[model samples]
Target: MKLQNSYLADFLSLLFPQLCPACGNDLVAHEKIICTDCLYNLPQTNFHLHADNIVARQFWGKINLETAYALYYFTKGGKVQNLMHHFKYNGMQQIGNLLGNIAGSQLNKNEKFAGVDYIIPVPLHKSRLKERGYNQSACFAHGLAEKLPAVVEENNLVRTKATQTQTHRSRFARFENMQEVFVVNNPERLKDKHVLLVDDIVTTGSTLEACAIPLLNIPGLKLSIATIAYAE
Candidate 1:
C-alpha cells in the first residue's frame, strides 16, 4: 500500500509539478517549499556552536545576551536572500517553518540553547501584522518550538508602535528609531526563565536590541536570540 501511494504521488507530481520557492525550478516529490539543492547550499553561520561568534559579539557592549545564533548567511542576490524574499514578501510563510525546523534541529544538538524555557518572536506592529496576515518571526518561532522542547509565546512581548523599514538605515539610525518600541507584558511569568527570542532575519541587530530591552526587565531572565538568517 505504501509503495502504491508513493507511485501515485510521483505520478501526480509529474502531471503537476510544484515550483521550488528559492530557485523557481520543478520540485520533486520530496521537496516542499525549497529544493534539496538550495537547502544544502544555504550558507550557514553555525553560531550556536561557538560562544564568541560574531552574532554574540554584536551585543557585547550594547546588550547582555546569553548567546545568539543565525542559521544562514544572507547576501545580496544570493540564494539565501532569494529564499528570504519569498518567505517574507511572497507569502511563502511555510518556508519559514521549514527552515526553522531545520535550524532548530541543529540548535537542539548544541548545548548552549538547551536551557531555553520559552520562545519569543520579535513582535510586529498590529498594523503590519494585519497587512501581512501573519508575523513572520512568530511563524519561525512556532516552527522552532516544534523541534525544540521550549514553548512558543507570542503575546508576552508587544510592539507598541509601527516604525519605518530599517532596510536603508544605518546601524545608529536603526537603533535610535527602534528604541523603546517594545514592551513586555505579564513580567511575572517570565522571571528567572531562559528565553529564546526569535526573528526572521538580523541585519543591524537594532530590532533585536529593542525587543530585548523590555525582556531584560524581567528578574532573573536569561536571554538568547535566534534568527533564520544573518545579513553580513
Candidate 2:
C-alpha cells in the first residue's frame, strides 16, 4: 500500500499530470522524480570508473584533486534539471537524497574514490539555509553517507559569508565572489583526512573550487568531489 503522500502525488498527477521531466512521459509510481524510460535513457557520464575523466580534467593545474565524478550528464530541460529545481526551489529534499543513494551505490565500488575518511557537503549560507530549511547538498550527502564507508561531518566545512546566487554570475565572477564566502570552522577535524565533497550539481566548477581552496591548505588533507549531475 502506498503512503498518503504517495497516493496524493498519484492523484495530483491526474490534475497536474506528472510528466517525466526528461521525456514528457507519465511517471510510474516507483519512478518518483523521473520515469523509468528516462532513467535508462539519461546520458550517464560514467566518470567514476575512470581517473582521467573530464570532471577530473577540469580541476587539473587549478586544484590538486585525487578524484572527481559526476553521476549524470546534465541536459537542458532534462529530468536532472527538474530534480535540481525541486531540490533548490520546491522543498523536495527527499528526492535529492534518493538520487544521492543511487549515485553513491555506483561510486562506492569505484577504485579511485577509495579510502575516503569523511563526507563533507558544501555548506549553504545561513540566509539560504533558513529559507530552504535545509541544504539540498546535505540531503545528498546524507544519502551518500548511508552507502559509503566513511563517516559524515556536517559542520567541519561551512559557508561563513552570505553571497549572491551563482547562477547569474559568470564563472570568473562566481569564483572571485566566493573567496571568503566559505571558511573552515573546525580545521582540527579535517587534518590528515581524505574527504569526499558532495554537492547537488557541478556547473563551471567555480563553487566547488572555492570550497576546495580553504580545505587544501589544511595539512595532509586530500580531496575528491562528487555531484548529482555535471553541466557541460
Reference-based TM-score, model 2: 0.88
Q: Per-residue lDDT tens digits of candidate 1, residues 120-213?
A: 9999999999998999998899889999999999998999999999978999999999988999988999999999999988888999999998
Task: Score each candidate by Cα lDDT.
Answer: 0.90, 0.84
How many clashes (backbone atoms < 3 Å, residues ≥3 apart in a chain or on different chains) does model 2 have?
A: 0
lDDT of 2 at 31: 69
Per-residue lDDT over 1-232 for candidate 2, one digit per residue giving the tens place of the 0 to 100 score: 4588888987887888766655667876666767887667777888987899888898899999999999888878877686678677877777778777888888889875658889899999888888889998889888888878888888878888888878778889988988877788888789999999988888889889999999999999999999989998
What local lDDT does model 2 show for residue 29?
A: 69
The weakest ten consecutive residues by lDDT in model 2 span 16-25
Most accurate candidate by lDDT: 1
CA error at residue 9 for candidate 2, angstroms: 10
